[model samples]
Target: MMNGHFDTDNPDKVIHKGEYENSFDNMREIALAPNTHKFVLNFWTEDLKIELERIRTLDITDNLTKIKYVCNVRPYYYFQFSDPDGNIIEVTGKYTPKEGQFV
Candidate 1:
């Protein structure tokens, strides 16, 4: 939800908080911005391969990392793509625990 105060000078214009009316900040400059921050989250599961296979059937342009077997450290995956905008939508499943090796 977008909320703002009415511009004091223009009675009808909505100005964002901390912004003044008639300021250069009101200009529209659209462009794909470079990602300067990193945000990564993981979902752990014993059936990593099952989950990966299930994800594959969905309508997704990106992919879930590995789909063979959950047999390593950190079987659940995450991936940050190297595209200009650094596509992080390519959800990756990394290495999970090996047999008898609990991680």
Candidate 2:
């Protein structure tokens, strides 16, 4: 189960425990850039801020630097970091999708 949503028999659909919002499952995998994949872990703005600050205080390798960027069309704030496996992990929040926006 993920985020209170359970995997359904339909590979493309996850059954949420309550009212569903803008969630989707793409059944097919697409080619990603070298050392990168489209796997993002989102968090609330406050939570992300706290977590990022905590990470900065850790005496970890310098490779785990944080990079911030914004998506103008949908308007979200996020930071990206590469894991040991080279998969891109994004800690994101503050999504301001326009009405009728298809995420």
Candidate 3:
């Protein structure tokens, strides 16, 4: 789980807290136009090769999608997918041993 608040006027914010069973931050963020729920997805994988494989085999509809797995890099492996509209979404995940490890 990752949660935080941003400057209402700013276009970005920081990651304050993240928790998972493993040492990874498997979080997904979606961005879209105002007054709309349709958006795009930003995602990262532990291994691009492995993540790609999982992506190919998973069923990611608008309602049944979640973080597939952890990404491979420090910031994490990145991929962008879109909704019906042209909104932008970002998904990222990482593995840390404890609370202060991911940073």
Q: For every model shown, what is its TM-score relative to the native structure? A: 0.32, 0.42, 0.27
lDDT of 3 by residue, 1-103 (tens): 2221121223243322323322122222212223332323456556544453465466452422233333222234233334445344544545333434422
Q: Which is the winner by lDDT between candidate 1 and candidate 3? A: 3
> Which pairs of residues have clashing backbones in candidate 2?
none
lDDT for residue 93 in candidate 1, whole number 0-100: 45
- Report lDDT (CA) for all predictions: 0.33, 0.41, 0.35
What TM-score does model 1 achieve against the real structure?
0.32
- The parts of candidate 3 lying over 4 Å away from their true place are 1-32, 37-44, 62-77, 82-89, 92-103
lDDT of 1: 0.33
For 1-103, candidate 1 gives per-residue lDDT tens digits of: 1011212334334323222222112222111123322333334555544555666666353423433322122233332222334333333344454653321
Candidate 1 deviant stretches above 4 angstroms = 1-37, 67-103
Q: Which should have the higher TM-score, number 2 or number 3?
A: 2
How do all the candidates rank in terms of TM-score, highest first? 2, 1, 3
